[model samples]
Target: MKSLNHRTKVVILTAVMFVLLVAVYACGILISEEAVTGSFLNAKRPPCLEHPFGTDALGRDLFLRTLKGLSVSITVGLVASLISAVIAVLVGIAAANGSKWVDALINWIIDLVMSVPHTILIILISFALGRGLKGLLMGIAATHWCSLARLIRGEVLQLRSQQYVAVSRKLGKSSGWILTNHLLPHLVPQFFVGLILMFPHAILHEASISFLGFGLPPEQPAIGIILSESMRYLSTGMWWIAVLPGLTLVLIVLLIDKFGDHLRMILDPYSAQE
Candidate 1:
């Protein structure tokens, strides 16, 4: 009967997304290809009860492929976001609390990294690192840390100026302790927001790179791979394969983004409580 707070709303929405994702994945895994009602005689079919997303050019179940794609996308988002946030925190502390020269140097590097065209940079880096998930992950990680670093740096800077940090300095608390205990806690809200925001970017980049035939392998079931495969069938009237999968990818990213925005609002008590 109680009205939902922003946190409650975000939590509920996120849980629903997760459940849908799990259902799609579990069904894809448990339901064998033969058990799927998509008929070989009707390959590349449009949306129907037997095949909600229809079939691909080869008569493979597009719906099932979509579930596998979603799982792969989630893998990219989770790993890249975790790596980005951790690096952001560590580098941010060094930039904030280290010598002035160190701060200047690291800040310059962050700016430089962000100034490049992001997608192109990712592709170049991925290609340079060689192919597959290793390259894709490295490419994503290479570019994703700057915003989080800036956020954590700002929090560290603010915390560094507070009276408690000043007192800690006078008390001879090690720089490590001040950063780990005092500054890091101050970064919690920013860190969480940065993390949630990072999810969509990472997923999109992964999908984009894969779609371009640069990230995940062709045989691997991923949203990008589905879309890429669909391209060849587009002129042949198998639009649903690409279209439906693309829509699913967009929907997932958009829902995650909306939830991230809600989380940012909720976690920043200043904004909600204001």
Candidate 2:
């Protein structure tokens, strides 16, 4: 039967992504420093059958490094987005269920976070945290959770207004039990949608921060760092290394973001119709 749920189709796309990322990551690990360093005196070769994506100034294989970049971007996006989603769910539920002051405080902090320019705020936070992987992860995660918090808060609010919630209150159900049984189920769809939406932001933020030199180090196989390295080589006519990887990164981000939209459609058919 033709399915209305879209699970099979979505699962296919997810599997494709999972396979692509894992393959690239495995390639990154097995690639020797010798291959990337181009000790064979073949640095800066243009794209050809032997060096499909071309070679960088240092003689590194662009295809390998590009895959490495993809791996790093995917890893960063996953880590930061997951952390943000968890924090958002916890904080949003707290605000939704807590007393007046608690709700106000949560909203107020969310507001404060939203007021700043996100990339700049991330940089400042990363700088303050000593500007490494930890700093970059913390910065990306910290800058990107308000929308998730709002989503969770709205879900919780809807749950609170439901008839079952009132009955639970009258039936001597503890707040914890009510939250676990009734509210948590409703929260899942919202959480999933919020997670997909957060992913692109996480990736773009990581790339931008790294481009500015506050994120992943230059020697690492990060997209932003690759692009940064290409800037110096561009005038000399070796543009494929940076440009191709960058285009690949953009395509990957767009694919994931569109996939997220598809997921939201799956979870909220009414929203899709609208």
- Please, what are the lDDT tens digits per residue for candidate 2 over residues 223-248? 88988888899998888977788888
Residue 99, model 2, lDDT: 95
- Model 1 collision count: 0
Q: Report the error of model 1 at residue 227, Å.
A: 0.6
lDDT of 2 at 232: 90
Looking at model 1, residue 139 earns an lDDT score of 85
lDDT of 1 by residue, 1-274 (tens): 1586655666677677667766755665665545534456868778999889988766777877787778788888779888888889889988887899999999999999999977898899889988799889988888899988987888788888899999999999998888778876778778788888898899999999999999999878889988988888889877898889899989888877876786776677776543
| Global local distance difference test of model 1 | 0.82
Off by over 4 Å in 1: 1-42, 271-274
Stretches of model 2 off by over 4 angstroms after superposition = 1-34, 269-274
The C-alpha TM-scores of every prediction are 0.89, 0.90
Whole-model lDDT per candidate:
0.82, 0.84
